[model samples]
Target: MTVDPPIRLGRAADAAAIAALSRELIEEGLPWTWQPARVLRALQHPETNVAVVDAGDELVGFGIMEYLDTDAYLVLLAVRRSDQRKGRGSALLRWLETAARAAGAERVRLDARRDNAAARSFYNEHGYHEIAIQEGGYHGAVDRIRLEKWLRA
Candidate 1:
């Protein structure tokens, strides 16, 4: 039987791999804004959490969230193509949400590409609600759906 990969805090060494995964899975067809340098910065940020699913030899998934005074923003979440549908993505998201709630965040917010129905459904399945739809929201290139999940009253 295959064991589920464990999720943990990202390290400085994992920045490049995480950035590459973001470029391939999340930022495809868009400008590669989450480069290694930027990812390292987030990893070093005090208010941000970069979580990864370490699959022994490599990282299979990752999620980056920035916690604010009242809420948290899910900057990105993605799993390697070969590792999808195995619950790694959902695990990473849940880990981040738990961290956000512990930090006193009332809600978690994120944006998904409107064309990616799978992602929309995935977030919705995780309790995220559609808050808005913005045309040209993705770097002024694609329509984006904004989603939010309230954590408390």
Candidate 2:
């Protein structure tokens, strides 16, 4: 069976799904945490969160962010386990970039675990470059690599 991809602004009800996806990604020994309540709170507050949903009306991925003057820091970007490798992550990222630009952001930044080679490769393919690396940044164990992408005006 085939499924149509849908990208749309997230609503409050999507918090659980978003959190579940995050937990799955991390629990599978990935490199992140899943906090459903925290994510829901952030999502309810438009000032710091945004999400992308699939055609099935399920939250597939989200981007938690914080604005720093003219730039937006992407705190997190995760796709559902069942939804990975289908271009959904890239589409959500593009949407986030567009949204950031519309909000007057000149650039966007995100940090990925240094050990997450898949994520690193994905970001590199999407025009994001490693600008810095924090040694032992994550949980005092795994290093974190900072990446940034400048948007065109």
Candidate 3:
């Protein structure tokens, strides 16, 4: 599932589009936790980052990552349902990793729900390994599985 290359850094004007795409793609309560307002806040935040894959003017996918110390935390990633399996997710992820490395991150971390097999597979295929899982990790609705990947040897 490969597409064209070059994922871009999301901007302030992209907040609405990113938020809309997330709402359409995410099938959980996490989007409800942040919503568009929270996304806008992240856009303005210095420690957080947002990257997107666009097809012309339409944003097809996005990922939000936060830099904490020497680690980059992937807070959220979503691709348009119609655009899934087309490499957008992977491209955005790669871009995030590059950004993180440039910011001195030695490793990247993310969390997925235990019920999300597809997400778990994606992370695994991208070199991320499960580190831990906490019961009722997602607002007591689902267990959150933490995954990590070292960027450098």
Candidate 4:
């Protein structure tokens, strides 16, 4: 299905949908369960949270950015499974990069499980470089790979 370009900072009412989609993606990537309420709380907070909505007014994707001094951490970025390859994820990432840059962040970083080959490839393809491999990073069950992308002002 063709989806319209996403609308930014859509609405608070879509937080639950975004959280549910995020939980699904996280669960698929890792063996952990995420609480929807907690996710909703974080997303609804006015700080560095952002979401993208499709023309149908459905929550297609969301991204959370945490600003720390001179760096911005992409705490979460998830797109619904049905919307995976339709440029939603890329658009969300681009928006986050711009937001990070506006927040005085020189770079954006995120960690993906080393075993999640698809995610690793996605990040790499998106201009993020793996700077380090963290041994036994995921509850001592999986390793974590750190990725960072330098943003241009």
Tell me, by lDDT, which candidate is best. 1
lDDT by residue for model 1 over 1-153, one digit each (tens)? 644468899999999999999999889999999999999999999999999997778998999999988999999999999999998988898899999999999999999999889899999999999989999999999999999999998
Query: Candidate 1's C-alpha lDDT?
Result: 0.94
Q: Tell me how far the alpha carbon of residue 65 in candidate 2 is from the true structure, in angstroms, after superposition.
A: 3.0
**Residue-wise lDDT of candidate 2 within 122-141, one digit each (tens)?**
99999999999999887778
Candidate 3, residues 1-153: lDDT per residue as tens digits? 455566877888888888777666564565366667889999889999888888777888889999999899999998887888888788889889989999999999999889989999999999999999999888888899999999988
TM-score of each: 0.96, 0.86, 0.91, 0.83
> What does the lDDT read for residue 89 in candidate 3?
87
Best-to-worst ranking by lDDT: 1, 3, 2, 4
Full-model lDDT, candidate 2: 0.77
Q: Once all C-alphas are superposed, what RMSD does model 3 give against the true structure?
A: 2.0
lDDT at residue 35 of model 3 (Cα atoms) = 68
Clashes of each: 0, 0, 0, 0
Where model 1 places Cα greater than 4 Å from the true spot, the runs are 1-4
Best by TM-score: 1
Error of 3 at 125 (Å): 0.2
Mind sharing the TM-score for model 1? 0.96
The global C-alpha lDDT for each of the candidates, from Candidate 1 onward, is: 0.94, 0.77, 0.86, 0.76
Q: Model 1: clashing residue pairs?
A: none
